[model samples]
Target: MFVRTATPEDWPAIWPFLHRIVAAGETYTYPRDLGEDRARDIWMLEPPSRTVVATDADGTVLGSAKMNPNHMGPGAHIASASFMVAPEHAGRGVGRALGEHVLEWARSEGYRGMQFNAVVESNTRAVALWRSLGFEVVGTVPEAFDHPAKGFVGLHIMHRYL
Candidate 1:
C-alpha cells in the first residue's frame, strides 16, 4: 500500500468507517452521533495542514490521517495528527505506515516535534503502534475518556521529537 494526499472524492469512502469508529465510542473523543457534514469539515483539512489516504495497489483506500500544528501561533512548531483505519484492515500495518509518513512529513516541514493530545489508554493497539513509531506517554488525564466497553479511562498525551 502507498500513502497519498486525499481528495474530496475520498470522503464517501472515508466517512462510513469514520462514522462506525466514532459511534463505537471506544477510542476517539468525537461525539458518538457526529454527523457527516461536521465530520467531513473537520477531517478534510486544507493546506498548511493535510489529510492523507493509504490505499492498496488497486487504489482502494484502507486508512486515513489528518495532521497539523498541535496548537496555534506560538505553539505551531509542534505537530499533531489523528488516524483511522478501516476495521477490516486492522493488523495490516496501515496505522504504522501512516505514522511513519506523518513523521516524515513533519520532519520535512521543519516541525520541532509531534504530539498526540488524546490517545485513549485502553486502545493498546494504537498505543503500541505509536510507541513503535517513537512516541511516548508524556502524560495521561485520568478518567478523561468514557470508553464504551472499558468504563472511564485515561487519555494519554503522547509526544516525540522530530
Candidate 2:
C-alpha cells in the first residue's frame, strides 16, 4: 500500500466510506447525519493540519486520516490525528500503517506528542491498537458516547509522548 496527501478531488471517493462510518455512530464523535460540505471542510483542512489517504497498488483508497494540532497556541506543540479504514480492509494492517505514517508526520512537523481526544471504550480494536502503539488512557469521560449496541460508553482520552 502507498500513502499520500489527500486532495479535494479525492473527496468523492472518500465520502462514501466516511459517510457510512460517521452515520454508523458506533465509533466517531461526529454527528450521525453530518452534512457533506461540513465533513469535507473538516477533512480537507487549510493549514497547520493535513489529510492523507492510503491506497492499494492500483490506487483504490482503502482508508484515510487527518492530522492536526491537539489544541491551539501553546498547546499546539502536541499533535492529534484520527483514522478510518474501510470495513473490508480492517484486518489487513492498513490502520497500523496509516497510524505509523501519521506519527512520522507529526514528528517531522515538530510535534512534542500525540493525543486522541475521544476514543470510544467499546471500540476495542482501536483502543487495543492505540495501546499497542504506546498510547495510554490518560482520562475517561463516563457515558460520553451513546453507542447503539453498547448503550452509553466511556470516551477515552489517549496520549503518547513523541
Candidate 3:
C-alpha cells in the first residue's frame, strides 16, 4: 500500500467510511448524525495542516488521517491527528500506515510532540495501536464518551514526544 497527501477529489471515496465510522458512535467523538457538508469541512483541512490517505496498488483508498496543531499560537508546537480506516480494510495495517505517516509529518514539520485529545477508551484496537506507536495515556476523562453499546466510557488523552 502507498500513502499520499489527499486531494479535494478524494472526499468522494473518504466520506462513505468516514460516515460509517462516525455514525457508529463507538470510536470517534464526532456527532453520530453528522451531515456530509459539515464532515467535509472538518476533514478536508487547509494548508499547514495536513491530510493524507492510504491506498492499495489499485489506488483504492483504505484509510485517511489529518494532522495539525493541537491548539493555536503558543500551543502550535504540539501536534494532533485523527484517523479513519475502511471497515473492510481493518487489521490490514491501513490504520498503522496512516499513524506512521502522521508521526513522520509531525516530526518533519518540527512538532515537539503529538497529542490525541479524544481517543475513545473503549476502542481497544486504536488504543493499542497508539501505545505500540509510543503514545502513552497521560490522562483519561472518566465517562467522557457516550458509546453506543458500552454506555458511557472514558476518553483517553494520549501523547508522544517526537
Candidate 4:
C-alpha cells in the first residue's frame, strides 16, 4: 500500500469506516453520535494542515490520517495527528504506513514535535502502534474517556519529537 494526499473524492470511501469507528465510542474522543458533516469538517483540513490516505494496488482506501498544528500561535511548531483504519482492513499495516507518513510530513514541515492529546489508554493496539513509532506517554488524564465497553478510562497524552 501507498500513502497520498486525500481529496474530496476520497471522503465517501473514508466516511463509512470513520462513521463506524466513531460510533463504536471505543478509541476516539469524538462523540458516538457525531454527524457526517461535522466529522468531515474535523477531518479534512487545509493549507499547512493535511490529510492523507493509504490505498492498495487497486486504489481501495484502507485507512486515513489527518495532520495539523497541535496548537495555534506559539504552539504551532508542535504537530498533532489522528488516524483511522477500516475494521475490515485492520492488521494489514495500514495504520503503521499512515503513522510513518504523518511523521515524515511533520519532519519535512519543520515541526518541533508531534503530540496526540487524547489517545484512549485502553486502545492498546493504537497505543502500541504509536509507541512503536517512537511516541511516549507524557501524561494521562484519569477517567477522561467514556468508553462503551471499558467504562471510564484514561486519555493519554502521547508525544514524539520530530
Candidate 5:
C-alpha cells in the first residue's frame, strides 16, 4: 500500500468510509449524525495539520488518517490523530498502514509524543492496535461515551512518547 498526503480532491473518495465510521457512533466522539460539510472541515485540516490516504496497488483509497497538534502553545509538541477505513476493507491492514504512516509523519515533524483524547473503550480493535503501536491507556473517563449497543462506556485518553 502507498500512503500519500491527501488533497481536497481526495475527499470525494474518502467521504463514504468517513461517513460510515462517524455514523456508527461506536468509536469516535463525532456526532452520530454529523453532516458532510462539518465532517469535511474537520477532516481536511490546514497547513500545520495534515491528512493522508492509504491507497492499494491499484491506487484505490482504502483508508485515511488526519494528524495535528494535540493542543496549543506549550502543549503543541504532542500530536494527535484519527483514522477511518472503508468498512468493506476492514481487517485488510489499511488502518495499520495509515497508523504507521501517521506515526512516522508526526515524529519527522518534530512531535515529542502522541495522544488520543477520546478513544472509546468498546472499540477493542482500535485499542489493541494502538497498544501494539506503543500507546498506553493513560487515563479513561467513566461513562464518557455512549455506545449504541453497549450503552455507556469509558472514553480512553491514550498516550505514547515518540
Candidate 6:
C-alpha cells in the first residue's frame, strides 16, 4: 500500500467509510448522525494542517488520517491527529501505516509531541495500536463517551513526545 497527501477529490472515496465509522458511534467522538457537509468541514482541513490517505496498488483508498496542532498560539507546538480505516480493509496494516506516517509528519514539522484528545477507551485495537506506537494513556475521563454497544465508556487522552 501507498500513503499520500489527500486532495479535495479524495473526499468522494473517503466519505463512505468516514460516514460508516462515525455513525457507528463505537470509536470516534463525532456525533452519530453527523452529516456530510459538517464531516467535510471537520476532516478536510486546510494547510499548515495535513491530511493523507492510504491506498492499495489499484489506488483504492483503505484509510485516512488528518494531523494538526492540538491548540492554537502558545499550544501550537503540540500536534493531534485522527484516523479512519475502511471496515473491509482492517487488519491489513493500513491503520499502522497511517499512524507511522502521521508521526513522521509531526516530527518533520517540528512538533514537540502528539496528543490524542479523545480516543475511546473501549476501542482496544486503537488503544493498543497507539500504545505500540509509543503513546501513553495520560488519563481517561470516566464515562465520557456514549458507546452504542458498550453503553457509556471512558475517553482516553493519549500522548507521546516527538
Which candidate do you rate higher for lDDT, 1 or 3?
A: 1
Model 2 residue 145 CA deviation in Å: 0.5
| Clashing pairs in model 3, backbone N/Cα/C closer than 3 A | none
Task: State each model's C-alpha RMSD to the native.
Answer: 0.5, 0.7, 0.5, 0.5, 0.7, 0.5
Off by over 4 Å in 6: none
Better of 2 and 4 by lDDT: 4
Question: Which lDDT tens digits does candidate 5 get at residues 75-156?
Answer: 9999999999988989999888998999999999999999999999989999999999999999999999989999999999
Which tens-of-lDDT digit does each residue in 36-109 have in candidate 3?
A: 99999899899899889999999999999999899999999999999999999999999999999999999999
Report the lDDT tens digits of candidate 4 across residue range 4-53: 99999999999999999999999998989999999999998997899999
Tens-digit lDDT track of model 6 for 17-108: 99999988899988899999999999999999989999999999999999999999999999999999999999999999999999999999
lDDT of 1 at 56: 97
If both were scored by TM-score, which would come out higher, candidate 1 or candidate 5? 1
lDDT of 2 by residue, 24-71 (tens): 999999999999999998888767799999999999999999999999
Query: Where does the lowest 10-residue lDDT sum fall in candidate 5?
Result: 20-29
Note the residue pairs that clash in candidate 2.
Answer: none
- Candidate 3, after superposition: displacement of residue 53 in Å? 0.5
Model 6 — which ten-residue stretch has the worst lDDT? 23-32
Q: What are the models' TM-scores?
A: 0.99, 0.98, 0.99, 0.99, 0.98, 0.99
TM-score of 5: 0.98
Error of 6 at 43 (Å): 0.4
Clashes of each: 0, 0, 0, 0, 0, 0
Model 4 TM: 0.99
Off by over 4 Å in 2: none
Instruction: Say which prediction, candidate 3 or candidate 5, comes out ahead on TM-score.
Output: 3
| Poorest 10 consecutive residues by lDDT, candidate 4 | 44-53
